[model samples]
Target: MKMKCILCAAGALAMCTATAFANPAKESEKTEFNRHWFMQLQGGASYTLGEGSFGKLVSPAAALSAGYQFSPVWGLRFGLSGWQSKGAWVSPENVYQYKYLQGNVEATLDLANLFGRFNPVRTVNPYLFAGVGVNGAFDNDEANALNDKGYTLGNIWSGSKAFVAGRLGAGVNFRLSDCVLLGVEVNTNMLSDKYNSKKAGNLDWQFNALAGLTFRFGKNHKKPQPAAVVAAPVQTTPPAEKPRTPAVQEAAPVAAEKPAVAEKPAPLREDIFFRIGSAQVRDAEKAKIAALAEYLKANPDANVEVTGYADAVTGSNAFNLKISRQRAESVAAALKAAGIAAGRIRVNGKGDTVQPFPGVEKNRVSICIAK
Candidate 1:
């Protein structure tokens, strides 16, 4: 008997777990890999400190970077940066001079909400990237002057020379629209060797902040279409007979009939959407919400069920289920504010279990009629 009771309890527990997993509300969808080409232009200021003919200088710098992120979470970036800095000569005579144009290329990895670890807020993502590449340096006018004076300036390089370099930085990427992104990042580059130019000697670090825009090209994930609207039926009234009917009334009075009233059809349901992995609705969904509010006002007896759904991007099955539920609850709250009766509405979140669409936007809300 004891063994039988234990088995029964285990079975009950399993059933409860299955029930929880079965009805996941939709809001927990994860962001997918972004495979597209992107470009950015950034300009900022940097202070250089290292071994160089010129001691130290602070200068304004600009960079134009273009790259492709094979997935939403990773990519490669190549940028050309140039700066002019004034440095004090440490040796013979104390003279300040400007030197070298620098450029490089590196791979970047995006860490913001990667792997569906967290809910996405705005489309903006903060990322930390590190990669190894090459930095090129060219001799400036200062190097030319030293050469003319017959000073033994090391390597008197005039064009670009490649040196091993790496970069570390943090940046935020904001999606302006479906295919455009605005990004800003600040990074510091460390070169393997010091730069030697006529004006400066050991400049070894390149640091700058960059801001630019990127255009994305690829297939867009499918999104739910707006609910279709159905108009109400119209009623017609019969025209009244003239007073001459009084003479005919002497024979037989005709009965007057009421006008036929048209029945109003049910209002269209509203659709709710969210940022990838987040419960917050995007601004684009405002119009849909307004339409929903109007529908609720017109149909007082209608009951609504808001079911949230998430994409298969992240989280354990249980966690995704919980996220989906929260998303539904959020929509329910919005409806309540729009005069929907609390008792007439139901809310639920279904994690990534059932996807309405195959892509990232699959994280969404479903509104069902209960009346």
Candidate 2:
């Protein structure tokens, strides 16, 4: 029942975290591996299995680790864990303390970033790690003294002993800030039987429970802003009044009236913005197309040119050119749907070669000019 309660609490925490940080603005972020290095320090207690009671074998432990995240889901770290360890003997019933240290290179897999959407602001992250290294045990003064008294402590060594060790662990890190995290982990290490100054004829196990802080040093992925367009404001013309002929002029011989000159309409321009990586016209932008169509119909002599562009940060030159053409086609389709004749509309794709806007996101846009 206690285990079930813990599981339930964990599930609740995950749900709350996901709901609270469901930011749509993070969708455009692209991961950059160069900015994901981190360092961690932890302190806790360790328990080694032997012939004594469980409480007697507990000792203090601490670790320091530095790692780099190659991707959102994978990382590699080198760490050192050390402090005091306890060992025991069976026949004489003795528990002896020793100083120990382990250095290992571990590979870490972040399950949260792997399975769920990657969010740099995510509150809870869980990961697993495995490693192999060497463990050194030394300073067994209590056991050495007992051995001097002729008490049989099997395979006693006065000097430090080294053994090959393997480790497996799982941990959860809670984000405390943009650059810091609080974490907890538990792991078991397997070492040769000789590491404990005993001949158990099998591998020995050491378990550690730790909690600490991790400092993340690199930058997170930068999310691009939504595309935007700057358009010339529409100008309205006031009504023109008709001229009245002079009644007195009727008596005189009618002079040939000069022909009135036709006035040219002002040029109209508009812009349509798109989300990154997409060429579809949004519902809100449909009104711009309609307005342009009306302007075109009012001045039948006018023709429109539509040009589309893509941002430079997103894709290859060829890919950008293709998508930019698609964007222009999308706008041309919207214009045709608004009853503008296809023959009067011209479309062009500039890709990233011609950036009309200063911001990268603003380049993902299509501009329309009617003249």
Candidate 3:
């Protein structure tokens, strides 16, 4: 039965792997997993190995654990799990229960992240774990009753017994949000023969089927980006260079009457940048919006064109387009709040279809041009 269960888990892992590969992942998500701490609480049923029917050996179980994820693929945790475990013999038709607590330090492997692209938003993650622990069994009154009845149970425990245990398990985790997850797991534990006080001649086996919630602490992504640098408005045309003086005196005598040319003032322009994956206008960017509003107010005839853009490197085309539109709308709203009439402001989002700036970070911006 244990071998069959192992095979079933292996088959499920293979199917998950196939599904991961079937989907297209252009780039891996850059979610920082280091230094994140998580806690889990679980409750379920436990089954112990015995000669009696399967239904006779089932009992209650629960567990609590806390751990740290070292990376996307690996983590370590310490957990305490156990409750009632039953031992039974069919020949005498006797069944007895005992309480036990097992504490284990286990290592975890995230199978989905290990086999496929690491996506922070991916909803489901399957994992495998193994560990070693010590089990403390006590409150064996039922076992004592069986022993007193001459049931031939070898060396019944009087008070308590402590023995080594080993565990192996697999589970699936459903991400509920940034810091919470729902999970289900099934694990088998191997313990010393004396744990059940039945002298079963071989090691005892205990199985747990559990469901739980995990709460994690720490940000999944790295630090929020710093404020973008605001570049000074650029001139559309270069300044005229000073003409060189004539080396010979004859050049002064040849001055001709020419039409006077009037130079045009440079158009006002400013850029408001945004942090990665965010559309909210920062306080620093607000100043630029106010300045742009002032320019519009100073020249009633001049209108400002606000165009928003997003980087091509981060999100999907649809996601990029959505955020780009949001970025533009946010800037336009800010301008309106600053007393700039909506009719005078023209706003549009280019998404990643156009790159107005050179760098990826610089592309996440809204350019305002007054003409």
lDDT digits (tens) for residues 35-62 of candidate 2: 4789999999888878887778889999
Task: Give Cα distance to truth, residue 225, candidate 1, Å.
Answer: 13
How much lDDT does each candidate structure score?
0.59, 0.80, 0.81
Q: Residue 346's C-alpha lDDT in candidate 3?
A: 90
- Taking the tens digit of each residue's C-alpha lDDT, what string does model 1 give over 143-187? 557667766555445555666767777666665775677776667
Worst 10 residues of 3 by lDDT: 219-228
Q: Arrange candidates, best TM-score first.
A: 3, 2, 1
* C-alpha lDDT (0 to 100) for residue 20 of candidate 3: 46
Clashing pairs in 3: none
Sort by lDDT, best first: what order?
3, 2, 1
Please identify which of the two predictions, 1 or 3, would achieve the higher TM-score against the true structure: 3
> Which ranges of candidate 2 are over 4 A from the true structure?
1-34, 224-371
State how far residue 355 of model 3 sits from its true place (Å). 8.7
How badly does each model clash, as a count of residue pairs?
27, 0, 0
